[model samples]
Target: MNQLELLRKFTTIVADTSDIDSICKYKPEDATTNPSLILKAVNLHENQKFLNQAVEYAKKKGGSKQEQLLNASDKILVDLGVEILKYIPGYISSEVDARLSFNQDKCIVKAKKIVEMYENQGVSRKRVLIKLAATWECIKAAEELKKDNIFCNLTLLFSFAQARACAESKVFLISPFVGRIYDWYIAQNLMSNFPHNEDPGVISVKKIYNFYKKHNYKTIIMGASFRNVKQILLLSGCDRLTISPLLLKELESNNTVFNRKLIPPTTFIKPPVSLSEEEFRWEHNQDEMAVQKLSEGIRNFGKDQILLEKIISKLM
Candidate 1:
């Protein structure tokens, strides 16, 4: 079997894109979309119609061009997501505003609103997973949403404490970022003599995954934001992985053997301990990498989202 087939035996592979065509081709069990993916898709040659239609819809909404553009862009995002869901059996993740990452109530309200938009178009709650930053407030927001039967995918996670908090709160899924971790290590010139199988991001996710497996937490661990095939291969046996289409294609073409490289929680090299809110906060504060990445990821997404909104305004 190819690497993709081998990995599938032990892990769920999810497509990380907003392109329904690509999702249908790969037939990923699930798919994830963010402003970055959506923005990229709408700009692609084949996705122009979708973007044009969104602009036209905004014009017909009978508002100022700017308001129409914003409405249309969000509508297009929801529409594309709903379309993608039609092809996959599992849930499709749609993100909330990164600006609301720190506001529990706002995150809950926006998540509910996004779900409602999907429901309005006849999409079921079981087929949608709301995406949020792995902030304390977002975790609390996810708790509230889960109570209402809404699943969540906590994105931008880069630390053990974030995973622990999510697992403890019983959130549906956690996406511990891999690429951003590699990016940090490279930026710090630590990759020159980097040790194989001991990647910083891979290690972080392993720590989180072992914790979940040991505790039997229902929250699934999804290693996301991959930098290359090496990281993906190292995490072949993870609960799930959200990989870009390019990486997915690479895995499919490479005829290399792949196996579950992870040792289960029982083989852990460290003891476990439960964390209180204060403890979680302190641990997160101590992890300079997570602290910096979480802030940078949020800022970048927020900036992109703003730029997207500006594009909408011009189209209006």
Candidate 2:
């Protein structure tokens, strides 16, 4: 069997894209879409209809350009997400505004609004997973959303504190970004000396996994943004891994034994000493790489979201 088939034995592979056509080709169990991916996908000629529909819908809404366009963009994203769900048995993740990455109340309101939009269109709440940034405020917002039976997928996670907070909040799932972590090491020129099995990203996820597994936290762990098939294979036995279709094809083309590496036994080391809010703040403040990267990721996503909204306005 190809490596994809082998990995499927231990990990659920999810397509991390807004391109439903590509997803249909590879047949991932579930799919995930973010503002960046949605913006990228809607730019294609084949995907133009998705954007055109948003424009038409926004025009019909007849509101201020900013308001109508953002509303329509969100609607377009939801529509495509609903369509994606038709092929996969698992849930489809639709992210909220990355601008709300730091706003607790706003995040809660937007998350509920997205859920209601999906419900209004006949998509059951259970089939839709709301993706939010893994910030302290977002985790608190998730705590509220969870109370109402709404599930969440925390994204942009780069450290253990974010993951721990999500677990403490009882969120449904967490998408710790493996590729971004790799990018951090590359930027630091630490790649040559980077340890594969216990790389920073792997170590971060392992801590989160052990915390959940040891304390019996129900929040699922789904590693995202993988740079290579090696990272995917290293994270074997993770609840899920959201991989781009390119890497999925690579795994399928390679014939080899895909080892199950991320088991509970590997976490024999005790979870990192727990930290209070103040201590967490201090620790995060000390890790310039984590702090800078987290801020950069949020800012980049926010910028793309705004750009998408602007494009919608022009088309309308």
Candidate 3:
């Protein structure tokens, strides 16, 4: 088998784009979409129909033009998700607005609205995971959502504190960005060696994986935002790995010997410790890399969201 197929034997592969063709091409177990990916898919001529469908739904539903456009933007995500679900048996991540990331009540409200949208189209809540930012407020929002049996994938995750807080909140899963973490260190000139095993990004994921396993948190560790194939290879045996189509294509062609790296420990290390808001903030801030990357990621996603609204406005 090629590396992609081989990797799938141990880890659940999730497609990280909104492109249905790529998801069909890679055939991942699950797929995720963000404002950036939705915007990319919106701009594609081949996928123009889905965008139009969203726009129509928004207009028919009716509201102020601004509200209509926001509904249209969200519908675009759910519309693609509905299509992606037809191909993948597992969950499809429909993200809450990043602008709601810092508001507990607003995040909860947005998440519920996204879930409601998916259900309106005959998609079950079980097959949809609300993707939210990893801020403390969002985590708390996820905690509330979980109580109602709505699962979530905490995104833009960068530090142990974030992972631990998610665990404490009993979130369904998390997407710890490997490439973004590596990029931060590179920007700071902190890398001298590039050994696959010693890779900072790989190391960060491993730490979170080991901790979750040791503590037996039910939350799945999904390694995401990989910079290269080596990062994916090193994160072998993670609960899941969301890969982009470009890298998925690269993995599909390579035939190489590889081994599972993240073996869950049988012995319980300790009960998972909880993180208070202050504790979460302090611990997360201690890691300069995590702090910078988390803010940067939110800003980037927010920018794409605005651009997506602009795209919708032009069509209206």
Candidate 4:
């Protein structure tokens, strides 16, 4: 079997794209999209119809200019998510605006709005995972959402603090970004000494995975943002892996055998040390790479979100 097929034996493969064709082609168990991916999709010829429909719907709502723009952006994201959902059998993650990363109340409201939009279009809440940045407030928001039967996928997670808090909150899933972690280390000239298995990004996910499994935490770890096939191959037994189309194609064509690199340990480790809000903040503050990348990821996503609104406004 090709590596993709082999990897499936031990892990759930999720596509990380907004392109309908790619999602259909790879047939991932679940799919994820962010503002950046949706922004790219809206500009594509084949996806223009969806974009136009959202804009038209927003226009008819007859709100203030800013409100209309925000409405259109949300509608476009859900419309794209709705389309991707038709092609996959499992969940499709729809992210809240990254701008709301710091406010628990706003994050909760937006997450509910996205879920309400999906439900209004006849989709079940179980079919969606509201994606949020792993800020302490966002984690708190996710904890509350879980009570309402709204599952969440905490994205842009980088440090053990983020992972620990998400697990403690009982989030449905957490996407620890592997490529972004690798990028930070490479920028610091620290990856030259590491092999594929020892890659910093890979190591980050493995640590999170082991922590989750060793403690038997129900929160799922879905490794995301892979830079190469080796990263994906090395993390073969994660709960889930959200892979981009380019790497998915590479795995599909290569018939290399991939061993399961992560599993629940025979002896579970003691539960992770707990952290209060102050401690969480301090721990996150100490990780220079995590702090920088988390800030950068939110800023980058927020920028794309604004750009997406601009495109919708022009179309309107």
lDDT per residue as tens, model 2, 1-316: 9999998889898999877777888888889999888889878888778888777877787878777877787887888898898878889999998988888999999888888888988999898899998878888888899898899999988877777777767789999888888789888988778555667777777777777787677789999888888878888899999999889889989998856887764334344455566766676677676787789988998999988987877776
RMSD of each: 2.7, 2.4, 1.3, 1.3
Whole-model lDDT, candidate 3?
Answer: 0.91
Question: How many residue pairs clash in each candidate at the backbone level?
Answer: 0, 0, 0, 0
lDDT of each: 0.86, 0.83, 0.91, 0.92
- Cα distance off (Å), candidate 3, residue 238: 0.3
- As a whole number from 0 to 100, the lDDT of residue 274 in candidate 2 is 53
Q: Give the alpha carbon lDDT tens digit for every residue of 1-316 in model 1.
A: 7778888888898999887777888889999998888877777788767777778767777687656766677677788888898899998999888989999998998788778878999999889999999999999899899999999999999888898889888899999999999899889888877676588888888888777777678899999999899999898789899999899889889888866887566543343566787998999999898999999999988887887777666655
Query: What are the models' TM-scores?
Result: 0.91, 0.92, 0.97, 0.97
Candidate 1 residues lying further than 4 Å off, grouped into runs, are 52-70, 192-194, 263-274
Question: Which prediction has more favorable TM-score, 1 or 4?
Answer: 4
Give the per-residue lDDT digits (tens) of candidate 4, residues 1-316.
9999999999999999988788889989999999889888888888888878888888888789998898888898898888889999999999999999999999999999999999999999999999999999999999999999999999999999999999988899999999999999999998777864588989999999888888989999999999999999889989999999999999999996767888777776678567899999999999999999999999999999999988887877
Candidate 1's displacement at residue 148, Å, is: 0.7
Worst window of 10 by summed lDDT in candidate 3? 188-197
Clashing pairs in 2: none
Candidate 4, position 255, lDDT: 90
Between candidates 1 and 2, name the one with more favorable lDDT: 1
Q: Which stretches of candidate 2 lie over 4 Å from their true place?
A: 196-198, 265-276
The candidate maximizing lDDT is 4
TM-score of 4: 0.97
Pick by lDDT: 1 or 3, better one? 3
